[model samples]
Target chain A: MRNTQVIQVEGLTKKFGDFVAVDHISFEVEKGEIFGFLGANGAGKTTAMRMLTGLSKPSSGKGKVAGFDVLKESERIKERIGYMSQKFSLYEDLTVKENIRFYGGIYGLSKNQIRTKTSQILEELQLSEVGAKPVRSLPLGWKQRLAFAVSMVHEPEIVFLDEPTGGVDPNVRRQFWEAIYQASELGRTIFVTTHYMDEAEYCDRISIMVSGMIKALDSPDNLKKQF
Target chain B: MRRLRFLIQKEFIQIFRNKALLPMMTLLPIIQLIILSNAASNEVKDVRIAVVDHDQSEISRALSNKIMANDRFSLLAAPFNKKEALDLMQLDEVDIVLEVPPDFEKQLYRGEAPQLQTLVNAINGQQATVGSGYLNGIIATLNKEIRRNEPLFFSGLPKHNEPVVVTSNNWYNPELDYPHFMAPGILAELTALLTIVLTAMNTVREREIGTIEQINVTPIKKWEFILGKLVPFLCLGLVLLTVGLIASKLIFDIPIRGNIGLIFAYAVVNLICVLGFGLLISNFAETQQQAIFVAFFFVLIFVLMCGLFTPIDSMPKWAQYATIPNPLAHFISVSRKVLLKGSGLADIKMEFVYTFILALLFNAAAVWSYKKQE
Candidate 1:
């Protein structure tokens, strides 16, 4: 149960009927490290991330996240990890503060914790003025940032982001990387998937996948040199 | 439990915040109950009658007078013959044609039974059935009067051969108010429609917006999620039922004759049954539009077979058996039995058991079909 190896997987695989989405993939993510999964649009990055986050059942694999088995103890795994999906997943009709409070509450936060966390998120995201406004009114960049913050409200050991910077501008993507870095500094492992090369450069280690298999695994600079 | 509290709270906030849905869920159903109760009546009054008096005798005139004397029957025409009366009926001017045959008075005087034929328009089944029943009652009373006044004519027959008078009193609803019979069923129906549509649309909407992916990754259990969705809508259904009850009392003076708590007890189980059915439908649907169509499909079947407007006994045998599993049918039956007939728990324990079993089955299917991993 050491914190060093927060995520460890061996021969992880997922299949849809006869189609293999994620082939026999193996990897490990250390605490406080930013791990990036780089692949093309249909490269099984999302499928693999879904298995790790307990959002999908892997076809075959030995995997662990935050000291819990991915297949046998997914509920426990869910409790110890955070996931922000590829789509904008927050409630658009709810107020900014209400969204934060709701996610925090579902994650078993105390009332006082939600109270303080609401204010902290508003202040940190500079959303205090629009705290009462519905999230549908927020800009895309602001909404993505708030989604990331809400995902980490439970302070889990690992946060999984699936193409978290898919459609935002470069300026907002840079701000999003800053949020990732801040989370890594807080000793939360960052497991993110993206095809953006610049975003990949921010990860401590990167795995580039082709089809369903990881073609290369190395530091971004080493990957650049090898390629 | 606390997680469930948060889920329910968030649901309520979203439900109330949606301007279009709020009024539709609350105000619209109440208005429907008020307006529909008055408009959807089965009371057969002012039946248009056309008499064809061929005999032109004293008894034929007496019969026509007796038919018209009742408040329910209205005289439309006094045709000279049966063909003229049939013409009036064909023109859609009258609902019934009472014919007095040529030997009508002569047959009675000769101690033979005279034929009195009545032709009824069978369109609008309820109006036809009840109007015919009223006509029969009036004729029976007239026959009894004739027999009593002309006892000497019946002296040849034995005492036991005389007509046996059967008196029928309608219990619970002495006056046979259509709204009194209809309000409780309408209340159950509207509550059911609201719960089913809302519950069916809820999860599909989350899936449509991709929020389900986020929820699937959370630590919340599947039962907790389903229960969370059900609880809020269950409360709304109960609130609607209460509102309907009050409106029925205020507007229709419908009696709440049974134990009031028992009504709510049955309502909770029935509403849960409806909610589970809705969730099961949502699990099969991938989008809100699909959910709505699927929900509407089932709701239509539920309402038509629920024995609300039509008697279940009159349904085709197979269709009547289909209502065995229909929770709405059972709910409306229990509603009328308890609210109108003053039925106690022992009297309706069978309905309670069946509704409870349906609830469990629907909820189990809903929970099983709602796969987080898939």
Candidate 2:
């Protein structure tokens, strides 16, 4: 599984009437790879990521995530991956512990499994004290971290994060990246999209998009010298 | 099924957490039932009358006394002539003018039918029409009495030439209690309003806040998500109906004449149809405002034609046919029939079957239109 590619897509594209959001982009992410998708706003990076995560259909191309076809087997793809959107996606009215348990339950975890994972997530994120408080009471930085943790509660083969640290400060972004690294070390492939160049520098490999097409795909260090 | 349970639990927690929602569910329906049933009534009462009695004979006095006998009419003034009575009506002091012509009893004594003129302020059409109908009933009764007692005036006629008497007995709601009639109809309306608006708003709110994007990436099935939404609001609508029923019984003394289970059965189908219609609206609307506007438009039409305040039979033929698809109208009819008329299942089977079909169709549309991925 380590040597195998978890995501394989060829000529994947998405169009909205007269506009092409994602155009014939081809890429493959190996197992345990922290693949960074970076581009300016409206450059189709998010659109491409949506296709991989089974949140949107590819217009006229074939793609597979975790060996499941994105077009036909999206439901199967959904069960094998976790997705965190650009917006904070947890229920703000629910307490931290309830949010975790809810995601765990929805992901097909047994009751005992959800209970154990709830405690484990609370302990790991150091959110045990605030677990009883509503997510609204927590600061912005804490909410984002909890969202990522909840997304990963089922321990999927891949976790797709779309600007998971959009509004947070530098220090919080560092801590959030640490969580991604920890998830990667646990053998979960992290397919993340971010606007921060510094965040792209941390990824094992990065793909830069320009006008709905990937312009460069390589190790960040090699791409830094090439640019 | 496990996923659906968690979704339902999460929805309930959110609904209760919103500060305005609990009162909207509990206190609002009770308040609406009490105020609407009491205020929105068709039975005209306390009509003010001014009598212009130029012929102050025994028969004229008896007619005036008989009009004032019932609690429906009260004497505002006994003016000297029709002009003074007209002046009272002009000042809005009296709603009606009862004119008694000169030689009123003499006309009866001579066996000549004399015309009795009455002027009514037609501004408030319901009050004018129903009030005049009441006056006509009283005058007819007095006319019958005179013919019976004064048989000597009709000596040339046969003994069997007496005027025929007609009596009316109101069925279902005897005494014509408007509140009793209104309570069940309003209950149906509130149930429909709550289920539709709440379901539509909550679904759009999820999309507006982007929780739906998170939900889309999950393994939860489409039917599971829909059931998650439908089940909680369905239960809430039922709870609302129960609260309204209890309140109507306590305040209006509305009798639950039929089997309680039959009412609930119709209510369950009605609510599910309403909720599905709401969800279908939500699918077309991208924002909470859009959902509410669309829901309000349909609800206004539904309530107006649902025969809650006005009888559906009175609506024009096309409008009456249009109300056939209105779930609120059907529910109101079924509710009134079962709750007030003591109607059994066989009596309301048509309404029940139509609503059940709408439930299936609307829910299918809601599911078909709700997309996990674009």
Q: Could you report the DockQ of all the candidates, in the order they appear?
A: 0.79, 0.82
| Candidate 1 stretches greater than 4 Å from native | A1-3, B75-93, B148-161, B313-321
Give each model's whole-structure lDDT.
0.91, 0.91
True contacts kept of 1: 0.89
- Candidate 2 docks with a DockQ of 0.82
For model 1, how big is the CA root-mean-square deviation?
2.7
Please give the clash total of every predicted structure, in order: 0, 0
The residue pairs found clashing in candidate 1 are none
Leading candidate by DockQ? 2
Per-residue lDDT tens digits for candidate 2, residues B74-193, read: 988999978889989999999999999999988877767777988999999999999999999889889888777876776765667465767789999887898999989998899899
Per-residue lDDT of candidate 1, residues B1-374 (tens digit): 89998999999999889888767777888799888888888888789999888898898889889887899999999988778888888899999988888989999878777778878999867778899999998888887788899988877766775667687899999988888988899999999998899889888999999998888899988898999999999988988888888888989999999998999999999999999999999989998999999899989999999999889999999999999899999999999999999999999999999999999999999999988886
TM-score of chain A of each: 0.98, 0.98
Per-residue lDDT over A1-227 for candidate 2, one digit per residue giving the tens place of the 0 to 100 score: 53499998899999999899988999999999999999888899889989888788889899889989999999999999999999889999899998988889899899999999999988998999999999999999999999999999898999999999899999999999999999999999999998789999999999999889999999999998998
